[model samples]
Target chain A: MAWNLQSDRPIYAQLVEQLRRMIVTGVYPAGSKLPAVRELAVEAAVNPNTMQRALVRLEEEGLLYAQRTSGRYVTEDNEKIMEAKEAMAAELISGFVSDMMRLGYTREQTIRLLEKKREG
Target chain B: MEEYLISCRDLGKSFPGCRALNGINLELPRGRIIGLLGPNGSGKSTFLKLCNGLLTPDRGELLVCGSRPGVESKKHVSYLPERSYLNDWMTVEQMIGFFKDFYADFEEARAYDMLARLAVDPAKRMKTMSKGTKEKVQLILVMSRRAQLYLLDEPIGGVDPAARDFILSTIITNYNPEGSVVISTHLIADVENILDDVIFINSGNIVLCDSVENIRAKQDKSVDMLFREVFRC
Candidate 1:
């Protein structure tokens, strides 16, 4: 998965986002085993500690699970994966709405634009 | 095992013309990464110094591993100052040798590996390197150890974005997992999420210290936003 350091968000969050994107995009399918922490850290040019943090965060959100000696693996539950995707979508949309409001977009105008964009 | 690795009781410090730190009480447990955040001249550096025994408290007691700072404490603590403390005349190898001499816990091979990753030549003198490069070298040296407590002051403050990433990655990859780290920096947004716990300091007083999850759930705001609201001045 591609990780961008230029984003204004925290690095661990960015790593999480990209890993989630990979799962949704079918790059890392359900029941797949993720890379080792040090290997991923080297790939991302991030610290293994930070990489572990992202992995732990994913584990906390139920997107991934850690096995005793098998390392971190993708969650096998499709329902949970769908729920995580929905939650992420809502959070992203809310963040966008706040940005639009800050940029002086009215609620009515936002609704109209969203409708038009959806139709086209 | 002790519940906390560090415990401070009414810790205070003052400069000739300024009160750097006021009465402060803090408890830091082992295996947790703490982000010590504050604005400029807000006593972040002074607090780190107090814990590292570089600066003595004026009004209270500070404890590390259940004792005051000294030779015994020095063996367990590794620190990286905000400014350059390394002599310019020495090369990277010499610096490694210095650490090996002073700190029995230092791993010279690890230091060389880290430097190699950054393309830092061991034979080059510190004075010959740029500011950012020198800072990276210093960070590599400090992190190449197995100390119990690491106190890093503005570890990423002097570098470019890429260099900052490198420095951060080095920290994550090298430090002992079970040990505690207290990083002092005003750049909260960049490092907020990775922090297991964060202690907000303002004007030498601790305003808040909590886990990232609790802060977000309770305050309904990210740590970065909270920092902006708290330190807007």
Candidate 2:
């Protein structure tokens, strides 16, 4: 997954969101080991402590768990991943719908526009 | 673990008629990347010089590694001065050797490895290498030391974008995990991504000290943008 961080928001929050997307999409599949914190930090070009904080947040969310000396792994619970994926999709759709509404489109019009696009 | 790596209290320094640092009180924790940011003549260099023990405060105390910057603290602090002190006659290898002889923490292998990565030949003399190469070499030498605190003064100020990226990545990968790094630069946008916290120093006074994430979250702006707003003349 790309570590496309921006300067406008907290980096660790971005990392956590991106990592959640990665795990849900099976980029780092269920039970697969994650890279070490320092390695991930270097790849993302962020402070290791920031990266670690993001990972710990993920752990608390039940998306990842660390083993003693063996490093972290994505949760084996596929159902949990599916739930997270659905939640993120809902968030994206809600954002899009609200933005469309602000542009003078109704909720029905927003869905109709998406339906029209899907057929083409 | 109980104390800050570098602590200052009512620290004051004056040069001739100029006040370089005034009533500075701050504490830096361990294992974080901090930006010492300000515009030209903002006393960034003077503050770092005091931390390196190159200049002593005229009033109050500035402590490094729990004590004043001295022979013992120098062992834990690796500094890259803003200016290159490379002898015109010496080769890169000789410089590394000199550092190795001077600092017990210096790692010759690590220095050579970074030099190779930069494609800078160790056998080349200081006079032959370009200014950018000399700066990179100096950075390599400073980072190669396993020192607890790395005080880099305007490290990427003069390099090209590609070289700037290289220098930053080198810093991230090589810094001692138990130590802290305080980078002083006016180039905020370039280093913004890597810094955990930033100290805004201007006219020898600290205007702000906050985490980068906190600033972005609360202020909804990059440190670079905030710096312009705060230090605009």
Candidate 3:
């Protein structure tokens, strides 16, 4: 999938989030090699320096790790990936509940609506 | 010899009607893609022109690669002005040849490679090409140079969204790692993600200059949004 970055947030953060998603979703599978900085920047249409910063941040967070000679790679730690995925799902659900609340629906009503949609 | 790509001390410039730039002082580091942002009649173009040695400041010292804007400094800078300066009769191939012959740092293969990616035929003359194609050709020639600084004036102003992305990609991928680029344009959102730093100017004065991330982090606003709030008429 293409990077669908919003204009409101910091691009570096968006990139890090997107790359993390890519890894968590197995788009870049565990132990898979990530593209070079320039190539990634070209694909995302972002500055290489900005892309490098995002990659470095991801590396620090253990979602990615750098080899001495070869390029970066997705972390092989399945637990860490699972944790990230669960965290993302929690965030998505939280946002959905809050948005539904703003539209005058209680948490119970929101879940009921979800269950009804699934059943239908 | 210079510590910065371009440094100025109390730099100022003017035309017959009014001042274009006033007492601007800043230092641009290498390996950066800086957005020179401002509204119409702002000093963005004038600032870029000073860096390119096309316009001399009226009051203050301006340095490019440590020396004054002259023959030695010109060699280190590649400039793309807002208007086209290509010969109408020159075909795309011939234009590339002219650039290769004119600029010692120009890369023929890179220029051709960019043209190929854009599907621009080398046989098309400048006069026969669309406005967008002509702009792309100019951008290709400018980016093909292995110069120390690239001063681009509104490079994506007239291009389509697809072309704009291609041009921006070309810029980020092809620019020399050791050099700096200053892009002056009104399309803030289009270019914001690609910029490392941004210099916000208004009415001949520099209002802000900082890293793009810092702006978003500190102000909690996008550069485009902050720009509108800052430069609202």
Best by TM-score: 2
TM-score of every model?
Answer: 0.79, 0.96, 0.94
lDDT of 1 by residue, B53-159 (tens): 88889998888877898887888888998789899999989999999999998999889988887888999999999998999999888898888888999998888
Looking at model 1 chain A, which ten-residue stretch has the lowest summed lDDT? A1-10
Off by over 4 Å in 1: A3-21, A37-65, A75-120
TM-score, chain A, candidate 3: 0.96
Clashing pairs in 3: none
**lDDT (10s digit) by residue, model 1, range A6-120:** 3334556668888887776668788899888877876776545567878899898888899999898999998888887787799988898888899999878888899999999
Residues B41-129 of candidate 3: C-alpha lDDT, one tens digit per residue: 99888888787777888999998888898888888999999899999999989999898888899999999998998889999999998
Candidate 1 backbone collisions, by pair: A47-B169
lDDT of 2 by residue, B1-233 (tens): 53689998999999898998988999999888999999999899999999988888899888899788899889899999999987989999999999999999999999898888889999999999888888888899999999889999999987778888888888788756689999999889899888989999999999999999999999988999999999778
Poorest stretch of ten by lDDT in candidate 1 chain B: B168-177
DockQ of each: 0.19, 0.76, 0.75
Off by over 4 Å in 2: none
The numbered model that scores best in DockQ is: 2
The deviation in Å at residue B103 for candidate 3 is 1.7
Residue A67, candidate 3: Cα error in Å is 0.4
Candidate 3 on A1-120: residue-level lDDT in tens?
Answer: 798878778889999999989999999999999989999998988889999999999989899999999989999999999999999999999999999999999999999999999999
Give the alpha-carbon lDDT of every model: 0.82, 0.90, 0.90
Worst 10 residues of 2 chain B by lDDT: B169-178
